[model samples]
Target: MEFSNTREFARSMDKEDPLATYKDEFIFPEVNNKKVIYFTGNSLGLQPKSAKKYVDEVMDDWANLAVEGHFYAEKPWWDYHERFSEKLAKVVGAKPPEITVMNTLTVNLHLLMVSFYRPDAKRYKIICEEKAFPSDQYMIASQVKFHGFNPEDAVVEVKKRAGENHFRTEDILKKIEEIGDECALVLFGGVNYYSGQVLDMETITRAGHEIGAKVGWDLAHAVGNIELKLHEWNVDFAAWCSYKYMNSGPGNASGCFINEKYHELKEIPRFEGWWGHSKERRFLMEPEFQPEPDAHAWQISNAPILALAPYLASLDMFEKVGMPALIEKRNKIVAYLEFVLHQIDEEVESDFEIITPSNQNERGTQLSVFLHGEGKELFNYLMKNGVIIDWREPNVIRLAPAPFYCSYEDMYEFGQILKRGILKI
Candidate 1:
């Protein structure tokens, strides 16, 4: 499967792509009456054209049913979040009983921490990857402080080897061993946000459990972008936002997976709320709490149907095109993107070092490139010329060519645009 950087070659690939038609399903932003070649699906996914219909249904329900919408609406508002369980379970590799749709990503992570990150007198340390997404950094630090421990001591970071862009699996296991009995929680982003490196979650989880530590993942970048097996990996918990590769609109609702092993365990403490209560006893409003015997047990508030609407819309798309097809396209498309980058680098005699792992298994849809011999000007050029990508600090461009909507032609088009930018043609 040789990749050539040519319009004909790209179009030939597109013609043969099974998922190629999906590009038409999304509404892309226009630049000079032309749709932009989007690559920032890692940051925020383009709106699904069907999303408006979903939102309209919710809005219409609110208008027509008023107070009775909870029970009378077409897709009843009362148990709307329940619609996501099986579909989301398929996405995250868990049973429906272990999946729940709830608050935004960080918010869900905070609530999950209360139940999983219970640092005690002897075991108070938390092990996480170095330079984790800033939100996770803040969450871990704040959680550590709330438990009356210094974040510097209690929050241990498994760092990459000096001069390396990615954290090695051996280094991570070694850190867990070093932390040993003092470690109470081991948390990491399933896929690193910066370098676009997919961490070894199965091995990490096994190692964490060996040390009597609770394991969790912030799958913000990993969820829809990569294949995951949270339950098979024996992960204690995991959370993800729907706005990125899930294509659920900006700042939409989140999804969570809590291992069913702890479903009704009395020893495990959770910040329970009304929605998390038993569905049967919910209307009873008893004075005591009896949580749902599933992942919904962590829900702190009622379903945000409006926010979850777009998510359900996207999940419906996931159902149509299962993960296997998406991953197949993802592998080929990402390799083509990498090949294009290399071709452009050679043609323009410019330094474009992709910091992302060369191995397809260790990377998702993103190629976080070190745009050497280029600067902010190159990023600006691409954006101005109808290419949408993400720029990180210093000099890095995170180009996540989402498979569902992004095409092989986009990779070729981006390469041409980049060549022109480099040569100022």
Candidate 2:
């Protein structure tokens, strides 16, 4: 797939793209009374046009059916979340019973840790990457402290080589072995939010299990963006938000996966709620807690129908196209974006260092660019000129060419705008 840095070439690629029609499914943001080139699906994805229709159905049910909507609504509010299990299972490569829709990302992380992060005196340490998303860092620290252990002593951070910005798989594996007997859990982000580096989850999971540690992942940035097989990888548990690549609306409900091996283990500790009880016996109001025999047991409350509706809209698109097709377009468009950026560097003599891995297998659609000079000013100039990318602290600009909606022309336009911005600075 050779790429040329020209508008005609970009338009030719777009004309040939199989996923080009998907761009119409979303509503792009307007800047300066014109549609901006959106490249921040890694942060907040553009909204699906069908989202309003889905939410309206729920609203109509509540307005007309009122209390009866719990059982009599179009989709039935009582079991709304259950509808997503099969679709989501396909997305993550798991059994339907192994996946469930529930609370927000970090909230689900804490709930899963309650069951998987059993820190005994002999094996009380946790292994994770340094500079994990701040929420994960906070959650790990709090969980360690909850067990009456100092976070500094119980949490081991695997750092990169002095000059590198991303973690090496070998280094992470060595750290897992180094912490051996004292490790209780090995938790990591499937894709680093800042550097956009995808970790080797299969190897990490196997290594953690050999060392007798429960392994989990925060897949917020990886779920819909990359191919995942949580069950096949033997991942103990995982959680992800739908707002990013999943393209659900802002602050949507999250998805969680619990390995089938843990499904029947009733003795495991969890913060239980009535919603997690067996639905067959829920109305009987039994005094004892009879947990569901699957990942559904993790639910602490009934489904948030409105929040879950938007996700259902997005999942409909995923089910129709499947992940294979989406990933194919992702690789091609990202390659074009990479080529265009390199062309810009050559033209302007800019020292733009791409911090994300060059290998396609080691990343998703995102490329994190470390700007060498006038970073903030150039970033601001791009924003003022109607390009929508994200800026991280210090000096990194993140661009994600989401396959579902982003076009090749957007990539070419971004390159042109980026060159102008750099020259202005």
lDDT by residue for model 1 over 1-425, one digit each (tens)? 98788999999999999999999999999997899999999999999999999999999999988979999999998889999999999899999999999988999999999999888899999999998999999999999999999999999998998889999999999999999999999999999999999999999999999999999999999988889998899999999999999999899898999999999795578898889888889889898888888998888788988898888898899999999899999999999999999998998889888999999899999999998778999999999999998999999999999999998999999999999999993
| Off by more than 4 A, model 2 | none
> Superposing all C-alpha atoms, what RMSD in Å does each candidate have to the true structure?
0.9, 0.7
- Residue 335 in candidate 1, Cα distance off native in Å: 0.3
The C-alpha lDDT values of all candidates are: 0.93, 0.94
Q: What is the lDDT for 288 in model 2?
A: 90
For candidate 2, give the lDDT: 0.94
For candidate 2, give the lDDT of residue 218. 97
**Per-model TM-score on C-alpha atoms:** 0.99, 0.99
For model 1, the superposed segments whose C-alpha errors exceed 4 Å read none
